[model samples]
Target: MLGQAVALLCLLAGDAGGLAFANAEPAWREKERLLENNKTLPCAASGTCSLGHTRQWTGDIYPLQGLRDCLRARVYRREIILVSENRLVAGFQLYDNMMQMGYDHIVLMSTEENCKRALRAWPQVSCIWSSQVFAATPKYMLDRHAFLPRAARLGVNVLCLDSDSMFLSDIYSHLKAPPLRDMALMALKDPAIGWLNSAVVYVQNARPDGPSVYVLNEVIDRLERWAEAREYMLGRNRKDFCWEQMAMSDILMSAVIGRPIAYGCWNWDRNVTYRDAWEGAHKRYFGYNETGGIGSWHFLKETKVPWPKSLAEHAPGFRRTEGVTHQQVIQIPNTQGVWPEEFGGPLYAPVRGNKSRAWMELIKSDGMPLWADPEDPAQAAANAANRELFTYLPEWIGIAYGQDGTSGYWNPALYRGANGTGTSPYALAHFYRLFGAPMNKLTVKMANNMWNWELSHLLHPRGGVFFASTEHAPIPDVLVYSPEVENREWVSHEEWDKATKALTRLAMEMGRTVVYPAPRCNLTWLGGERNNHLPLEIPMQFKHQCIPYSPSGKGFNDNRCMLGGYLMQGCMAARWYFAGGMFPPEYDHLVVHIRDKAAEHPVATVAAEQLARSWDSEELAKTLMAQHGGLGAGLFHPKIAEKLGAAAVPAVPAAAQKPRVLIIPSVLQLTDKVGPREQLYRDHEREDFNVMSCPWIQNKPFV
Candidate 1:
């Protein structure tokens, strides 16, 4: 026991691959013992160590004891350890997010200098150098969780994720230990999908019975198959995703087979609002309401949980002014109160002049603003035009004041609600878009508001479900684009709106998210001539969008600053004055680029009243049609006679739950027989565990 403890402690104290344990008992025994006495272990600054905990384990787990000792964070000792991969733009934002949510044991695997410098100030935080994570290729996903085995070896459960995952409240509450199940999945029942984001994952022991290890192996196996089957990419930035989703989707949906293997969720929804860059960027102003009602907060069909209804009611009150920053109103802290009515909208700016200048941007001439120049036809015309156009947008696009009372990407409207504002916070949002530290007023206000709200919803055992629900990472329901037409001409808002209006109207009717082409930044329109348009980028309604200056790329990883992803986020909004279609590898359709000016015609975004039936052999299809309308998920032809039937039924959500199956061998018959619920259903059924219980037979979709 002492030898094993020394070995594990040695591993933490700059020893890599030096210890070889012949017996699992000793290693496993010390694993918990050291962890139990982790506080006594040497710390970074504490003189209790030999060489002082070194950085970069090369491929081993960098000693994480700094936080536990220096700041008493006891990071690895916590049952639910939160880990994330941090890169540029994702720095510090994720760290502050988890801390503000009050999660104590947090580690951000980041090598960026900014993250290192920033986190270095606080000994409570662990900033690790991780090259095996956030890889540019899908094959690297196997490396993504290499740290998990280390955590498992230490007997701690880990929740691994990407840096963009913004937690709304206390994730610790849902994930904190009591050992409810082998794995607590972050997904919804309806989608019946598992591993929604792949960014957020939870793991326990590496044993076969441990669901985390099982699911992870399955994900790696699936990725291995896909990687083998995949075509080679010609370029360096081969950004491919949705790798583990299909296989995990099969594993999670076993409830459809009446025998599920530890599928799970959190907080009623599977971590809602994964991806919402295009749609959410517009939600700062007004949006559609729930009940699919005709109201402002309409973040429909995006994820398991859409944007909360709490903020929707306040949307219309957000932007009183559009695209114009009021001189110098005090930038005040809006924490713990109703969302203050500061001016602004989550809308695009009219890029009609040079230097990416918005027509509404404060234009100074003769040392005075041009907005005051009524004599200037362009200024007068620009103001009139934007106001008239606002009514047509899918959601309100009030270009409002951001941080510092100037036009900024940080939208105040986003933090208006009191509950979970950031779902795993935001995924796929471009970095540098209103990004910074915990001190940022917007970050504080959002975190504080969620903490205040969570006061009422602490997890309770009698409350019924074992874990909280989570959702898929953000992915575009539909991607809308328009060619900037050789990067020379600009798409007029009228034409842009007309095209998007037609497209979004159709998509919404189909219950899908629809996007209109809104460039993150704009270019100058010089003398209406091709050669005259100097490529000077400027401040506009949408800031932080460096795409115009960035070299275009095929995907997210290709962008130099990670900014050039409009086709991958860029060039599409660059070249296409107008384009419409779903993003590639998921849905296939090329965007139809409309002419920049005077083009008022379009259609073909694919819309209908309902889904057209798609199926296999006519015999099965016909039988399904004749009986159950259509086969959903899968089908089991009225079976080879078991003389027994167990219908589909989801277990009711509970606050906490016991093991789904409690087995007793025949030789060891239980003194207490099966619970009355199990006894009653002995013929082939069990009592309701609620609608989502995996053990209960719900092999088919209720529909």
Candidate 2:
């Protein structure tokens, strides 16, 4: 008999995958076959079959078999079941929100047509047609009651969710506690009337005879009868619509039988239902507030609003200063010389100042006022004197005016070359004043050392390379840089040197000129080296290229006033430093100093013809020589040197044809500086790629 029962179960379990209540006919036939064979079946101790030992047990086997099949279908697990109808947009938002919280097994119960529409929108969702339950009562009253019996018969643990609710956190994980787990049904207590709110219902499929199904059927039958007498008892013109919650509350409140697992944390009503009780009793259990925490919210009145649009509307505003004068600005001290106390003592002022004091007063005390409103005559004279004095200072210590005409700040634009159109000439003149002689008297060895230093310390650390647009050009046209490499894992010194030399050679061959503009001053690769000392160990013969050209002998190197080598000639190296290596304006005024020079010289009128024609043919020849071993004897093979001069000079593209300006914008924003996203969007507006602010094209609805 046991063998026969096992054979029967194995046969029925084969079709268990298709054994829904809607398709129970095949399962019913299998149950009849088992009974006809007079096979003894497993039954619950309290069930009808156990009540009378003499009576035929055939009638009791069907429900038990149905339960077995339901269990076989693998429905008894953590699952989300939602009742939704025409609320397609709300449903989608709920589904999306659930997905964002990492809940995947979601089931939608609705009419066939509604289910079809929802499946079309989100094909990954599982749907069950439930319009038949709505035939007796209006959808809302029947919707919550309908899934319980069906889910029980299907042998699944279910979390019945309202379509309007948003799950803020993982509520399912909290339900595993012993006290909450022991209960067969769990829901939020309605604060308004002390009734159970059916917004969130957790049904545990533990009963072999399916007690939840029996209770749900009894509630539905009682409600159907109550619908007829409701109008007469209440003295109303029409039948009083019975809510499913009232039926569920009745069953839960009864003393005769089953009790529900009612906990405040599991079902928190957004309407603040039972707030005091929840706070006092279950708040510590859940560790969430009225507005926050918990697993889900019944957005009772929020059915009409879409989730994304609602979130956007309620997004917090950016904090802004009350008044312009109250706005704070940082003041940095001079690194080169003594700064006056009025301008804030030596490092930087910890406290911020208002615009008037930060902009006007600091400049007045710092020497001649560097930036002032042009409309004021005295201010203009101070600005002029500041610009004149900027030429006498180091190239790094210049400033440019802000987009607003009255303000001037630090600018990092590098003077790349005669063909380089973006750099400010005043910045270039200063660069020439410091390193003009060696740059003019170019050497292969000098260029190589400069290239090595720039590559190893700056470019390689940040995953950047100097790339020229023209073929086989020794010097790169622009520095293509990525700020993302700043936080990358530290590389060994040998690995860094190898990557630098390899990328330099590749950039030369590919005619690509680009370098990363790192924004921070503290380089992880440099370890603990002071700013005054060079990080790399240069050979004694190559130290001249590494050392700053301080003709005045006032210890420019001591203060680290000049960025050494011929890379400063075109200001390419200087621009890289300014973009990211320099400290923020609040901590360092180096950019402010650079921008002052840029404002005075302004890119447009600053010796364009002379600068454009000024290329060092001597530097170009030596660079080509160094490429094939003419400069350093042991650096290249003898055969490679023999073949060096035989190669013809690659034709330099006409200056007009060369891309004069190549802007490699920073990908990430600095904490103190204005974000680069907006500027990047504006720059790439005509390009094919999408910027951060633009709508995600793939997710957008079709026209």
Candidate 3:
């Protein structure tokens, strides 16, 4: 019986071991399953919980689940992608608005240091150190391009926003379902330049298998290649490198299909004024309509101006101004403190008039004093002192008489004999006319002779004038003139240099001076018989002594400063006057004329046609005036032409009426050894030719 019992115990033990083994099968299977799940998680390979390559967010794969949960929880769901430097003062405001809009997932992308700093300030915000993935040094537009691909790679729907912008409403509600499906990227339209403003762009990356991310990468790559090519073409040192929006446009137009979010609905540029903002605030809504409810207000460079009082309550750091009369207040340095009422004007207002002051100072320092009455004892005494100070002033007569016996043709008498009339008195009389009262006959004659001597050297073929030192260099005073020449044969580098030297010497003898070349053909009426009527209003407003001639080129009759007549200072000054530099304003347009013989060949015919059309069209006249800030009218002044008995208004050609493009040729002379000016001309030529050759305008009306 004992032996049988022991055998039964052994059998029981064997059965127990088999049961244990069967139970262990599930545990082994569970271990394998866990390993598989871990492999699929983003951190499994890196052995960390973080997600993404460049956009390394915390909380591992679980955070992604949380994101899904957050999206499911929201009525109008979307993620916010904000790219900015850590030093951006408006970031907190942007973040507050995003939070108010119910965006739980806020991804901030910036340089590593910036990301760290931002995370310290706002611990709840997810930050991405872009420099970790993007090898290039971050630039304004380039940084945004670098981060956008990373956002797309995150496999989530996101709205990319500039740090300067703020959301006023649920932006997703404005987008319809069909348009959203068709759009890979949606951006607001820039009202001024008619391009897409990437400041507030919505990128759809909802599906795992979506082509948006891939397409975005492709677009970025293409843009980079294009930029490289452009750098090679224009040289890397070119300051006006293509911005990110330009690249975005090229990509969207060429590769990806996208839609422009309505200007009022999504992008409200600076054109939406403070008044509009206040009205919108009072209404408790934002747009671009009569109701004035803007979806997003891009303050742009106007950040220095204070927010309206009604809207200031919504922004945390913004404070309402006290005892201030101005429409806006400047933001003070301290976030909590208000900008003092005494300093509560526009930040630029104080500096806006600084340029005018500089101009006034320049005029005071360099401008010649007005001539006094010849009969006055004080005037006689002053003239005597000046003559003694500048012993060479009287020698100018000797110089004209060729008493020095120089070989070159600098004599006024020689020029008079050759050109048929005595040299123009306009240049010499210009200063006296501007600053001095009426002059005696002898004094006027002296002025006329001095002007004649200068003009002889300038227009004569054999003339040579050179600057002796920096003291004799040309002053910055401008005299604007048309690029047209009376004689094309006179257009040479030698003549150009001599003419410039003549003008420079005249300025030194007189005061600070500048010469401006008007890009288009027009006339101005200096006082005399022709000054009866003023065609444009700008000269009248400025109390100008000279007014623009009619676009018809009429007042040109008996005018020695006519298109092909003798070169005169009155004509040049008229150009300056028409270009908005009326006495007090600073003259910034300093240009030297270099004639291109090849280019000039076709210009004559086209110029005549354009001039005729310009004379007839009041619209063109207003356009020209507007172009120069309401300074002067069109390429051709009709009233002047009519007054001059040259009014032959031509019918607008069918081709000329279509949206015309003005081709502004370079004033620089290009040669084998290309300088900066020549290079600029070449670049402009390339751009202009490319634009002219566009297929869309092949048959369209154009100038």
Candidate 4:
């Protein structure tokens, strides 16, 4: 027969690792004896079954080790079947660990092909494959076909497991708990996305009526759903892993299983769920008095697969229990530094049950202070001093404040460069005044980079780049994209091509032109020809280019700062791509320069001017060396701020022909001692003349 004999061994264990369950069952014991005494047995059929080694562990800075350990522990207890060439080698390791604890009916299962390979290596074991039982067929379905038949041959009761699983607590007792008389086994119900999680599960092998044909059918149906929705598969973009989990869980939940209670079942993730458990535990364990409970946890590691050399490696004294897991945990020093501490947890009074003053001081000193006091003379002095450091713009190059980042209870006016003066929102009424219409120019800075797509898309419908007559509407005539490269991964090539082409086409429709800096060849290549390359490497440091903001709720992005800088930029960019429409143009003469003095290269000038044309600048100038004798010679000087001072300055108007220009100070925000925003005004009415700062928390974007 093509089908071969299969054996199933079950053992009880306490720790997620199989060591605790080694001698728990007779079947396990039998396996142990085979490993110890049987020298003549086929490598594939005898001894302990071992799997592949997982990657190394680093510190809590990386989570891969914890996840690997958990999975290894869970798989060790089972009579695992492996259809691989190194059956004997694999079997030996599995047997070694299982027998060490005492239980051992470990069997190494493999296919004939694998057996043949094993023969050349250490072939002493028997083998099996679906071809042994099923008639000759294609090999693609071998794994699927082999699974059920192998389980049936193993005596009707089997546990199906994914590679990523582990046992942290004694699961054997629960597994061994009297099987439901009617149902042979029970399995966990999966959770939905935008819903709760459904991970750890229990399964009963036999049902009084029959095998779980219903459950199997449900799996088949969902798999079909997945097949139909192939384009939307989670694996497609390598993003939205949660979607994959959701899809799988949705399928699992489709089954009409009996009331199956869910305990802590972990899968391949560690997010809010894990953080919450630890948070709650830390709170209670430190005397908060709340019942701290965690049914289960998935130790999904970070991208770096290496495991921590030891617990101490993740955090000092992490291995040695510190004071209160809670108190000490507060300043869970970010091993990864992926996000700031504020998002990690609530700010306690730096006090714990023990109330160590030193510890309190340490917690208090975790992150930098976020607020700035305008009244403080030191702060004012600092702001004033920093203002001189800025490279002033030309009189013709109007500075209009774009609503790249604005937040809260009032309408923030755009900075209108024409007629020097601008409207400032100092009171709540300003918000009411500017409501219902789009604000002035939505500056496509790093923070609001996403808005670029929105304008691009909206303007694409009408003349590609013209502003709408409506208030806060878009005037597509001018569009800007800067700080070149960032979050490049999330941008889909298809969407990019569509958007760029749309931008080009829209510019023509509006009877305007487009001026974009040609992307560096290398960057263009990185994204292929389809995507726009906005590299974050140049014009500013990563610190200045990326900022953290809230996501969800009454906060930015979603109120939670769970997603860090890169993702936030990607999401906003995506949203901006779809945000449709341009605002009314409040300015006529808006000059954009592409030159930065430090990087004195012609290529920069060439690229900047090109970019200026992309935005349909009314006029363009190229500064040059004296030898060239063009505007280039006098256009930009070594100390050009002095030369620009001699030119006729535009008079400040009550309301700029353009909306108030809000200088967000993105890349410019850095290279300074303190933040660049003006400290004087709060709302739009306080000062109608432009030049104001929104109530921005340090490192936070306006909602």
Candidate whose TM-score is highest: 1
In order of appearance, the predictions have TM-scores of 0.29, 0.27, 0.27, 0.22
lDDT of 2 by residue, 1-703 (tens): 1123324443444433222344445655775664444323212111211111121111111133432332333232334345453444444444444433333345455555766665443344445543332223675446446556545544466666655343323344334432244445555444345445565656664342333433444355435544445445245322233456665554443211111222321233435654454434433433345543222222111112112221122222212111100001111111233332221122112222243132223223323213233224444333233210000111111111111101000111111212322212111011111122323212111111111222111212332222111122222233222223322333543343333322222222223232322211123333223322222222333223232221112221212111122123321221111121111111111222224554321211112232233223233323333332232111122332353443322333332222211222222111222222223223433343221111111122111
Candidate 1, residues 1-703: lDDT per residue as tens digits? Answer: 1123334444443342334646445434544544444344222112222111222221123334422232233333434444444332243445444443333355555544634553433333455543332222442344444455444434455666555344433333332322212233332111112123344455544332233333443344323323333333112212122334444443332212212121121011223342232223223323322221111112112212223232233332233222211111001111121212221110111222222121112111112222112223344333232210001011111111122112111222222222313122211121212322211222222212211111111121121111111111011223233233112234443343334333322322221233323322332321122211112223443233222212111211111110111222211111101111222211211122112211221222111221232212222223322332222111121320222243422122322221111111111111222222222223332232232222211122111
lDDT tens digits, residues 107-150, model 4? 23345455455334322232333232211122322233233222
**Full-model lDDT for every candidate:** 0.28, 0.31, 0.29, 0.24
Ranking by lDDT: 2, 3, 1, 4
Query: Which 10-residue window of candidate 3 scores lowest in summed lDDT?
Result: 388-397
Per-candidate alpha-carbon RMSD to the true structure: 30.3, 33.2, 36.0, 29.6
Instruction: Give the top-scoring candidate (lDDT).
Output: 2
Alpha carbon RMSD to native, model 4: 29.6
Per-residue lDDT for 1-703 in model 3, tens only?
A: 1121112222322322122233434433443433444344322322321111122252211123433332333213334455453432234435444443334345555555655655454444455542222212235445555445444444455666655443333334322232233344555444335344566555664322233332344334433433334434244222212445654543333221111111221122346574455445423322234564332231211122222332223222223342111111111011111222222111111121332343223222322232232224444333232210000011111112112111111223222233333221100111112211121111122212211222222222232111100121222222222344321223333354334323222221112232322111122322233222211122221222221111111222211211111122221222211111111111111111112322321111123233332121233333332332221122123432443344322223233221111222212221123222122223433333432221111122212
Stretches of model 2 off by over 4 angstroms after superposition: 1-80, 83-85, 133-136, 208-215, 228-240, 255-703
lDDT (C-alpha) at residue 201 in model 4: 21
lDDT of 4: 0.24
lDDT accuracy of residue 325 in candidate 2: 8
